[model samples]
Target: MNWFKPPVKSLLKLDLQHFGGSTLFELKQNMATLGQQLQKYEGELSQKAIDPSATLEDIKALQKSKEDIKARFDVIKEQHDVLEAEQKASFEDKSNIQNIADPKAKIVTAKAELIRATIRNQAVPKDVMAVLGDRNSTGGEKLLPTTMSEELLMEPLVKNPLRDISTYTNLRNLEIPKISFTLDDDDFIADTETAKELKVTGDVVKFTRNKFKVFAPVSETVLRGSNVNLVQSVDRALESGLAAKEKKVAFTKTPKTGEEHMSFYQTGETAIKTVNGADIYEAIVNALADLHEDYRENAKIVMNYADYTKVVKFLNNGNSTYFAAPPESVWGKTVKFVDAATDPIVGDFAYSHFNYDLDVLYERDKNVRTGIEDFVLTAYVDHQIKLKSAFRIAKVIPAV
Candidate 1:
């Protein structure tokens, strides 16, 4: 139960004053050597310039050699700079450790002294105190009087009041998970009720995954009826199962497997209006950004949007547009959207996500017809840590 007994010596037992001393000295020495090499090269180049007998080729060769040396020297210089920076950091850390004052040691010592004082006072005889003369002049009676002076009793003996360093040490070393931040571009968007009612033509949104398929709005079924009731066909797009297309593809439908829906233009909700290989990238970026900002500060998320067009075209045959919904083959991953209390910004635009790759773009512009958009997002955490501290100070002696 006794967790602590003050060490006879100071808290800093480790000899860290020389912690990075040798390494730093060596790094500085190496840097000085590199500098000297550069100076020597410069001197050699200058001396060669004074040789009138030197042919143009000889001069050119010397210049080339000097340039090569300078390039190599520059690399060494960069290395030196990096090493020096590390050395400086290490030095600062050692300095911090050396100057550390432990608060825990002081607190423990205070408690122990108080306990010892109480025990010593309790052992004194109460009868002896009652028999004492001069009640005014007699100092406050000890619970059990000892031969020691009243002055010594009045002032409790305290050893190294500032000795407690454990609390301070722990505070200085406190660490938490490290976090980084980035943006993903792909984002999902929903359509307005009015747009759905109008039967507006648009791109068929598509997405893929490693296994299994999720046809969003899979509930949104598409049925064939008279052209007069294209509204019915559009309504079917909201449901899952078969859909008949003959009345011209509204949202350029790739008719691929997995989740397929109409791509509508929504600002932050979705990055692309059309679902295709082109839009797949944007959707992915948006999805990543959402997940990144929401859960992990800086998480490494890997993703590749399923080539719905390739698979869809393969399944649907010659026609790019069809009424059929995607099968499980062409699938996409699902990432829950977590909105920030306040949205994040990147570049000039305030976006919830950021895309690492620029090549991923909208599919509509690339395709001869209105393009298909892709919606997909996948993510996982790589690593992280954090360092932090706090402090509190109290004066045990109250001011009179």
Candidate 2:
């Protein structure tokens, strides 16, 4: 049920874009104001009934006025109810934990087991062990809660710049077909029957996902006694570090042994550009122009937050007090300022890809001297930017 499902004129009054998912707030404020108007009309009507000079026409007018406010209040209340339901439904949609049996029971047991990984759930904990028994012959009882899975797996797709743009695949270990650096030189037409297939044999680049590990250290007492929300709270924050590392390597790492692709920020990594222009603004434009037309349309200029500030500062130079700037885009191309990488890169991200089905492994290390146990999570991730010439690397020398 949409809040804007009213008559044409009434719906026109609704500023959906201006408010941007603030329909509920508008409905709430409208209802409150309408309710107040109705109360005012009721008070006026009562006073008119007590006064002898008050005519029937005046009393009738107040009745009509009160009725109008009441009708508006009903409409606003209906809109509020619809929007509230939508919000609740969205939260309900992210339940990957439901894939497991007795999800609620498992979450409860999981929290307890995380506090003390060494102990088993005596009353019979669930199948997180069975799920991983294949990987580890003897598996542990700790299962990540449904809420935690959403934070680590689902949230990063929307929140992390590198993760968002990279193609998400489930294949943990696979060969990516290499991007051909040079075009087939022979332009001579071959007879259709005798045309031989493009003859290169070693055509694929291999990418094996590597395991990333992070730990949250807590005292034995806090683990066993503290609340679920408080103890080992940094478990969720680990995703950011994992995500940052992936992005930096994808966009900057020189190809290691058996790796064929190059990241954008490396010199002559596919295409490299130096600004021949006099000023910083022209340098940015030159970087944008350096990318091939085939890639530039979809390309994003990835830079540091500090570098992006230069664009904003340039836009606001004339306005000392009231200033406005474009929303992180230039020349119709999106500009991404991310925490993961510092050097500027412009490229069509379709050429970049990463595997996504994060399988989180649990481990623990206990220090007898400190009475502290560290809960370590391990996950495997892979990334590559396959296409050459689709990316351009640039370094801007700031004005003196």
Best by TM-score: 2
Tens digits of per-residue lDDT for model 2 on 281-394?
456577678766666778876667776666667766776321233444344567676754555667788877775444566566666787666666676666655554456555
**TM-score of model 2 relative to the true fold?**
0.56
lDDT of 2 at 11: 45
Residue 110 miss distance in model 1 (angstroms): 38
* Per-model RMSD to reference: 33.5, 14.3
Model 1 lDDT tens row, 270-316 = 22221112233343344334332323233222211233343355546
Provide the overall lDDT of each model, using Cα atoms, as 2-decimal numbers.
Answer: 0.27, 0.54
Q: Whole-model lDDT, candidate 1?
A: 0.27
TM-score of every model?
0.20, 0.56
